[model samples]
Target: MVLLRTLRGPAYTRILGIGDYRPARIISNEELCRHIDSTDEWIQDRSGIQQRRQATPDESVVDMGTQAARAAMTYADLTGSDIDAVICATITHPYQTPAAAPMIAERLGTKNAAAFDLSAACAGYCYGVAVADDMVRSGRAEHVLVVGVEKLSDYRDLGDRGTAFIFGDGAGAAVIGPSATPGISATTWGSDGSGSAMISQSVSWTEAQERYAPASLDMPGDPARPDATVTDSLWPFIDMQGPSVFRWAATAVAPLCERALAAAGVTAQDIQVFIPHQANTRIVDTLVKKLRLPDHVVIADDITDMANTSAASIPLATAALLRSGRAHPGDLALQIGFGAGLTWAAQVVQLP
Candidate 1:
């Protein structure tokens, strides 16, 4: 065991490049209207998604991730060899065995790059960025690619209004590097296992009812079984409690944003932009009103075009802002990610 020196304060992280990928197939609300009892107006008002891109049945998750990753690398003006590590954040990577990060590494030909995947649900991107930052700051890896790619459409129950209307498919990537004056500042992250039911499905419930019935039920906490699980079904696909999640996000996000800003020694007024998790337009709108942040300081745009891309939301929004020239180097960017750890993570980053 080694005695630690004073806690290193504000280690640098820069967002060197970023990109987002939306598949070519556009599925309109009218398309959903034909299949389900949903109107364009109702869907738009509720989720801010008028249309979303769906991947072709043949498109692989790796293909999508690789496309976004290449564009990000190009934007960063760096080659594969320049990357020291790659962090891929995906909940829909197509396989359970080999992590997609390494596969993405192989595709990008980042042979020397250290790679791994982080499944933090929608908060995965923020978590991945935090991990990559530590690696560079601790002198383990210098340049890292943090990718948030997901294809939630594969698991979505299109017949279920609550789940189907909310999720869309997409990918986003960012290149994070070391800088004395960081593009990223302090981050604040939190989780509540209690709310796990609000966003996940229970696979064990099915197995128990089908495979073992009656007295042999697999309920983790039968008095006979002390080791029974307190909860079940964190697998299969995401099942969300929309109104509850919106309320939680609205109530929870601002304080974490304030906390992240405080940790960075900055104020809301000092922030140049806010790239919050694109969970819902309503939640984003609600928090913007609640925080009293300036019009220039917060960006809640893009839900109309993309829906919630889960972990990919923030980076996609960031890329749009840069593309539109709404942002410039030296701008202060505040990003927050919340969901399915029933968790929230916030970071205050300075943009280059």
Candidate 2:
């Protein structure tokens, strides 16, 4: 066993860089309508999504995540060897035993860096940001990489109207390092477990496996029979109560934003960008109106192109805003993420 040493001091943490990786395959609304009972106009009117990116089989969650991380490191003018820790936020990691963080660290060549994964659904990115800030402030780390990635194409049910059109695959990352001045404010987070079922998998993986387990090696029915069939449950896919989620997002999440702003000692008018999770365009509009933000505040609408990327949504939206010239470094931005766990988190931070 090895001994560990701890350090203590007051430090400030700020995001040094941001990066994102969107899959190459773009699926238009017309293409989606082919598989589900949805139309371009209907999808636009409801979700404001015209197209979404779907990852190919070659693009695994870790692959996209590592790419985003490398880009972020480059933008920060640092190398993998410079990182002290890594935090990977995702719910779509294919393996159940080993987390995705260590693999990401290994690929980044951060052999001595502490690595781990966090699962908070759509709220994961913001939570990771909060944790990174705290870790730096407490002198536990000097530089940290926070990555949010998802491969929802593997979990989406193409025939389900409720979710078939709402998910996409992508990854986004940010580099957090010590700063001489404050760059990130306090975070506000909460969850309503009673509503956890509003967004979740239709069935658990173990349950699905058991449901399809063979009754016996000897076939119960004739193998050649035309009518022979096996009773099995629907494939485990992401599902959501659309109305419930919309209601909760539009109404309940506004207070969390208010709390975040208050904690940061800022007002709605002080914000330069509002980066909420790309869950729905309508929800973004609702929050903007409910918060009474000024017309000058740029709101992220990445959902139109990337759909809801769950834990990756906030970082993805942030990167898009910065890349589009709509927001700039040192700008004040408010970010909020909510989903699956009936969880939500928010924070106000200055851009890199």
Candidate 3:
């Protein structure tokens, strides 16, 4: 029997830097209300979103992700050659075969680094952070680029009142590398697949291709199909059971956060910031009350301005806090993300 040598890495890992990209196009509640039957006040009372960003038609998921990744790398004082791996978390990449990570890696000029995509819906960014932290500490990668991006405009249904005004397009990224002291703590994450249907696309890709391909293939000016009209059903749009999701998030997620804090061996008073998923203000408020967090802990409310950028929410919120001087380097932050898949991930970290 031959003995194999084992690889070991650093004692700790920290997020070296963070970045995000918000598209230039801003869609206010008044504008969104023009398409849906909702009023701006109603939308605000429901989801606390006054506006959101939507990428242009030419902006692909890779494009937004690459820009965000570049920003993160720049903040970390790193270049493509320094990245050993890239992980992109997204559900709206539009392609199923070729993942978005490698494309982002190519755009960044990475030197053949390991790359892949992750599909954890809104919980994705936090999931990527956990994975990157492990990879760095295990010596699998020296520096890992984790990007959470979503071009949700492609899947938005203006006619759907429940979700039409709830989503936005954006990208956020982080660079994780070795640290002298612990910066990332144990992550408390889990999923309840039983509630998977609470938030999802109206149809799978297979269903869309099989059901709508024949009609979609016809030319618009074809003489035989001069009156052809494509309905919203021809493409998959976001479908969500709002009440159920809100209930689960408001009630169940607080305990998960408690576990994360406990796992980190810290109390709520030790945290300087609380960055929860920018899903809804009501949910955030409920979690705050349940956790009994003090007033000094700055809670992120980026949802009011950014809407739900799915996986990009936490990091984008983090970046906002940093820019506004609400959060500082080495400050302890407790972050949690939960959505779709009824998934949830929470962790405590020292902000970069």
Best by TM-score: 3
lDDT of 3 by residue, 136-248 (tens): 98899999999999988777766678888998989999999999999999999999999999998888877866765566555242121133223233357789999999998
Of 2 and 3, the candidate ranking higher by lDDT: 3
Give all TM-scores, in the order shown.
0.87, 0.91, 0.93
Summarize candidate 2's per-residue lDDT along 1-352 as a digit string, tens digits: 9989877745677999999999888888897786677799999899988888877766788999999999899889989998989999999887875889888999999958999999999999999999999888888888899999998877776657878789889999999988888899999998889999999887888775565335423324212111221221223577899999999898899989999999999999999999999999899989999899999999998999999899998888888888899999999999999988988889999998
Q: Report the Cα lDDT for residue 99, model 2.
A: 86
Measured with C-alpha atoms, the lDDT of residue 265 in candidate 1 is 88
**Model 2: lDDT of residue 123:** 96
Instruction: Please give the range of 10 consecutive residues that has the lowest summed lDDT in model 3.
Output: 222-231
lDDT of all predictions? 0.76, 0.86, 0.89
lDDT, residue 147, model 1: 90
lDDT of 1 by residue, 42-101 (tens): 998887888877776567667788888888889989888888888988777757779988
Against the hidden true structure, what lDDT does model 1 obtain? 0.76
